[model samples]
Target: MYFIPNENLDPTLNLAMEQYILSGLNLDEEILFFFIDRPSIIVGRHQNTIDEINLDYVKAQDIQVVRRLSGGGSVYHDLGNLCFSFILPFPNQPVPDFSSFTEPVIRALRTMGVPAEKSGRNDILVEGAKISGNAYYHNKFGTVCHGTLLFNTDLTVLARALNPKPEKLSAKGVQSVRSRVTNLNGYLPGIKTTVEFRERLLSEIARDAKTIELSDADLANAEGIADERYRNPLWTFGTSPKYTLKRTRRFPIGEIELRIEVRDNIIRDVVFFGDFFTSQEIDPIVDALRGSELETGALTAALRSIDWKAWFPTIQEEDFAAFVAQGD
Candidate 1:
């Protein structure tokens, strides 16, 4: 196996690099890649971004939100987190075996005195508390099994940034996100920093592995890929599947209810019902939103373009836009 080093802190570029490596490279032996991203939220491919994250908090905290190629629940990443991926040739088996990929990491953790065990389908837990969440993507070229290791992650920000559905939390029998997760820091007695822990883990996984460094041309290509897809809002938010959103907010004037139907992240239909007084026709408001993209900026601009004061004189366009788009 060979190891590739990714020192970039940008999550979008990191994902782009992963794509470049997975599809662009012609590989014979397996490849191991590791990286750490600055504060960011990476959502699953099939998940609705509006439902998975606290949009207002994510925006206010200046956290980059990117959708990954794999399918899994959303996860928060910071400098304290370490991410690892293994790119291997397609196996001949009928089903993808996750244990084969996660066993090595679990063994490495156990060797380090951390009681790590594979939990459920794609999670690694320590003492029944989750420390790692994993997902994978397979293509004609190969399969990429990747996951996050919470070396010393910020549980506070993670809990605040992730907005898992109430049913999801209830099904897990956990009250809060922080209650179900733990950092590896408590288990490692001597490891002081995530960097040091990363090196230690790497040594255990591939001590004799060859190292591959990215060339300038490779980086430029990855950056182009990042610009084309990873950094594009269309790919990050617009790729969501068709869904209906019903949001009700109570203002001082009255109670407002909005039922929006979105397909491919574009609003297809919108219905407004409320006790609020209106001096103008409501058709224009619904028309303005029907074709708008279900994103913060797009929804806000669509609402601001119309004379909202003529409808709800007490409500602000920005606030209503946030409510409509974020579903918070």
Candidate 2:
């Protein structure tokens, strides 16, 4: 096994570097690497970034958002959080097991007296509180398993950043569950800084491991990939599969449920169902929203252009705009 050092703190660059290394995999060698990124939220390859985040909060806080190569739930990372990756040749095990990939981490934590154990499907818990979450990706050449380890992360920001669906929250049986997570710093009184925690963890995992250096060409390729793909908004926020966006709001007038089928960043269809009273037919308003850009300004202008008071006298144009663009 070889230990590769990551020098960049950009989430996009780090994810690009992981892919770059994974693509250059040799069947005989495995590589281990870890990095700390600035405040960011990384969504799984199969997840909808918009659906996983509070867009208003993310934008206001200016947090970096990116899509990762592995499929798993969204995770928040900051300088206090450490992310580790292992790119290894295909395992001989017939049925892939997460434990095989996570046991090393568990061992490392246990050695530090953290009492870490593999819990549920793909998480490491410290005294029944989660400290790590893992995700995996497999290709013809090898398997890449990577995850986040919370050392001294800002739990408050993490809680507000991820906007999981009701079903997912209920399934996990923990609503507003950031409190269920614990940081290694709390357990390791000896460690003064996150940097210390990272070095110690790496030391435990990479005992007498060979250090490998990436050539300039390798780095440039990774940077180029980051700029062209990982950093692009299309991959981060716009590549979600076709999905229905449902938003329900209780206006002073009545309750309204807005259902929209969005495709390729366009509103393909829209329906408004509610107990709200209207004098004129709402078909025109629905048609106006159809084929329109899923943008607040455009939707607002469209609504303002029509005599919408005949349909919804109690609501304001800005409210309609906010409702459609809120992405709730």
Candidate 3:
């Protein structure tokens, strides 16, 4: 095992660095890196960015929001927070799981007198309150397990920055969007500061581990990746799989709430729920929309093929196509 020092503090660059290392690792190599982001919220790969965050609040705060390549819930990061990432080679078949990858963190915190344990799905809790949240991304080269450790994070900002929609949380079986989290700063009163805690954790993990440095080529590759993916809006916000696209149009009858699920450039399913009155059932129109492509041209063509006017007499086919083409 080897320790790689953190060279950048930008959330986008650090995420890109993680991807570069995880994808470029050799089969026999294992590396650990520690970093901190300057006030950011990282959304999971499969999460709906529009649902996970309050855009107005985020823009008002000027907090950086980036999407990670891993699958997990969104997390808030600040200068006071410390993040850890591990890239371990799995030469044999590796069943991607959280408990095994979180061992080092559990051990390190336990050594620091904090009773940290792997809690429900992907969190590390201390005395029933969470201190860490983790996620994983795997490739043939290696597996990367990265997570956030709230050492001395600002709870107020953490609360305000993350605005997960209540309905979406309930859909995931989460009771509340607010996390029952605690900071390591309060738990380790003996430790003077967050820097001391970081060093102590490093000491626990870096024992007998080689120290390595990122070469110029590695930095260049990471920078390229950051520019191409992390800093790009398409990747950060446009890649969310699950989003509720709602279109409300007032007709002579009543209002229509056209909610749809568009994923992988395909319209997977849609539900037209509203107080509008219809003589004929809208099941056929809804059935026709299933598995339809998301592009405006393709969708317009598909809608033209269907006689939707009979079901939604007041709403035109163009309006339906336009509504379907609303979101990213």
The prediction achieving the highest TM-score against the true structure is 1
- Per-residue CA lDDT of model 1 for 1-328, tens digit only, reads 9898878999999998988887776667888999899999998764567777899999999999998877667899999999999888644323246797889999999999999999876789999899998887766667788899999999999999999766556656899898999999999979999889989999999999999888899899999999999999988787433349988765654345677888899999876544332334478888889899988899889988888886667888888888999976
| Candidate 2 lDDT by residue in tens digits, 107-223 | 998999889999876889988788998887765556778889999999999989888666555555677758678788888999987778878988999878788888898899999
Query: What are the Cα lDDT values of the candidates?
Result: 0.83, 0.79, 0.75
- Residue 87 of model 2, lDDT score: 80
Question: By the TM-score metric, which is better: model 1 or model 3?
Answer: 1
Task: Pick out the ten consecutive residues of candidate 2 with the lowest summed lDDT.
Answer: 272-281
Better of 1 and 2 by TM-score: 1
Candidate 3, run of 10 with poorest lDDT: 272-281
Question: Ten residues in a row with the worst lDDT in model 1?
Answer: 272-281
Indicate which candidate wins on lDDT. Answer: 1
* lDDT over C-alpha atoms for residue 72 of model 2: 62
Clashing residue pairs in candidate 3 (N, C-alpha, C atoms within 3 angstroms): none
The alpha-carbon root-mean-square deviation between model 1 and the true structure, to one decimal in Å, is 13.4
- Which sections of candidate 2 miss by over 4 Å? 25-27, 89-95, 239-328
What TM-score fits each model? 0.73, 0.72, 0.71
